[model samples]
Target: MSFDKFKPKYKIHSETENYFKLRAEAGAKPYDQLTVEEAREGNIANAKRFAGTTEFEGTVKEFTVPSKQCSDGIPITVYRSKQCDLCVAPSVFVYFHGGGNVVGCRQTVDTICRIFSRDAPCVVVNVEYRLAPEHKWPANHEDAICVVRWVKMNKGLLGAVNRSTVGVGGDGEGSRMAALVCHEVPDLGYQVTCIFHASAA
Candidate 1:
């Protein structure tokens, strides 16, 4: 059957409608059908395409956080608003991308980080945690905790004050990770001012 017949009747913005149409046209294979490497490549490609088409008015910097086993450390991208320097001390927003612990990287959510940095007027840090089943359980969660600690320890370099507001956010699987971080981290209440998940009501 034609994909158009499956389009929702509910009202949606033209841009969103176009996106859905394009997605349908692309005929991308389901995640379950693709190998992990193939899925990662597709996810990265989609992110790059979206980044290219969208306009983000923020300064982006790349950094790495030391991981438990890997000496290379975890990759992270920091997005700061253009006016961040004008503020007394900008807040920090750590973001985790929403793949099912298997298919996303830091670049997968570049646009989301840019949007948060610009709209919230905060420093947005995108974490690139190791995925599974290559890494196994608790690896992603462990990385999340480590990144949070790293940010807390280096707030000065991140353009945030010691007691400045810090928040954690994510979508889908990433949301689960954010919630876990908030729950499992000791004395997190003293540092994290908020926890935001797109799927949370």
Candidate 2:
């Protein structure tokens, strides 16, 4: 059916309906009003609540890059495909999490990163950039730029094909950050596709 901007139609699935119902019963605050701590907690809690007991296949090598080593010295977790190694590596995707850049961290998007690494059969760099209400504006953007540059700068170690194979992306706010980085950096490899959606109801 063709969509009508003024008269859009959709249904809230029962499962989704129940989730919100449960949240209401538990006194979950509206998103706009949530305290920073509450917002952070909700991101983690929702991830666990939805993913209970489910495990996806992948391999991970994690490490912290001191500020001296990479952008802002962020904590980065590298997820790899089962078949991936320095010999098999050709590209790296740097990802950022949503949460308005206020709530999410590396862990919040762990599952997707693992899946991306495995399915793409490439290295996934999950970056934990400084958040707002703390780091301030341009800080996140700077971190994004620096991290992508770091990947390009360390392509030999990351097993990337070359500086041109270093890509960057994120969900929600992160996607916009990716675009900003692409705009500012001029030459960040391929940018991963980022899709977003919202409901007016």
Using lDDT, give the best candidate's number. 1
| lDDT of the structure predicted as candidate 1 | 0.74
Ten residues in a row with the worst lDDT in model 2?
Answer: 1-10
* TM-score of each prediction: 0.80, 0.78
Model 2, stretches more than 4 Å misplaced?
Answer: 1-8, 11-22, 51-58, 66-72, 85-88, 159-164, 193-201
* lDDT on C-alpha atoms for all candidate structures: 0.74, 0.71
TM-score of 1: 0.80
What are the per-residue Cα lDDT tens digits for candidate 2 across 74-180? 77888766545534445788998877767778887888887777767678899888898887887788778777777777766654555336788888888888888
Give the runs in model 1 whose Cα sits over 4 Å from its true position. Answer: 1-18, 51-58, 186-201
